[model samples]
Target: MQEEEPRGWRPAVAALPAAAAALVYAWARWCFGGAAPPSPAVAVAGGAVLVLGASAAYALSVRGAGGLFGALFLALGLLSTVAATERTAARAETATCVVREVHAETEASFGEGGAEKTVYRLALDCPGGRPGELKDAPSPLSRGAEVRIAYDPRGRLSAVPAGAARPWKPALSALLLLALAAVLAAHRRRPQP
Candidate 1:
């Protein structure tokens, strides 16, 4: 028997998982980075819903391109949800910080054709009055600026300019989802059982 030719709609269907993952990630980030974050319970519940929906999508799509995308989406959704929950917990323990200094440096990359990049670093005086440097702080921050830092009992996890929303989580999540989609698409192109 001959194998069936691939259909155009398959690619579109496969993309749904990545799109859904992006939306979930964005929602989670927005919730956590907002002035009033949802309770941990709410975050966890949202995570659970995302995971379950992704899983169901995966199950329904098994044995096709959709299956590959669904699996990738499920993994990303799970990771983003967990990160969101952790951020929520950290937000509950946030502290105000003062930017003591803003240091910008241009550095050349060692590999990949030695590209140049500008790095922004901040010196922060956080709660408890201890001073430390914050590497890779968001740009446009200046000396003597006040910022908010989120931390657990052990250490800081994030620093954002005062009244600025944190964008790393959602951005990272979206990037990962896109990468996963690309990988799954490549995998799907390979001969299968």
Candidate 2:
């Protein structure tokens, strides 16, 4: 017997949550500009909504939806956490870094507040002048120019020019993405009936 396609509006349903999330993010970034912090309860509520919506959408569709969602969420969450942490570290202090080299020009993309960010790469020399320091720094810099690089010691390649980013926002966003990916991955690997 031929296997039947699961056609209960799964793809469209699944897309709703993701699309909502994308819209919410875009609104936050464009209108708010990270000027205020969200209340914990509100943040939690929003997260719950996103999770449920996405899950419902996926469940209505095919068996593979879970795995794909998981990976997508995981990647995004991790990125948000890193960005938020970096913003906080750079808020107050200024650390001098020499522009070691500009990494080859690549089209860098990021979501800020919710809108997309277009960025270019610049390799910076750390305080102690460590060689091979061409790790990805988020901000654009000219080769040999000095800049104040603010970053979390625990998160490499998660820094920005001290004055450039809004602390906490990006991090929170990245965390959400990472968490979603993890949860989806977990669910996908489970034994199903």
For each candidate in turn, the TM-score is 0.43, 0.35
Give the alpha carbon lDDT tens digit for every residue of 23-113 in model 1: 5666566455645657767866876777667656654544466465547665665576446544443334556778888889998899989
TM for candidate 2 is 0.35
Worst 10 residues of 1 by lDDT: 153-162
Candidate 1: give the clashing pairs.
Answer: none
Candidate 1, which segments miss by more than 4 Å at Cα? Answer: 1-7, 35-37, 64-73, 77-178, 185-193
User: Which one is best on lDDT?
Assistant: 1
Residue 180 displacement (Å), model 1:
3.0
**What is the lDDT, from 0 to 100, of the residue 10 in candidate 1?**
53
Which 10-residue span in candidate 2 carries the lowest summed lDDT? 26-35
Per-residue alpha-carbon lDDT of candidate 2 for residues 1-193, written as tens digits (9 for 90 to 100): 4554355443444344455456445433422234454654665465556545554444433246675665456435533543454344323334687887775554435655555444466666676543324344565667888877655443323455666667567766765664565445333432354
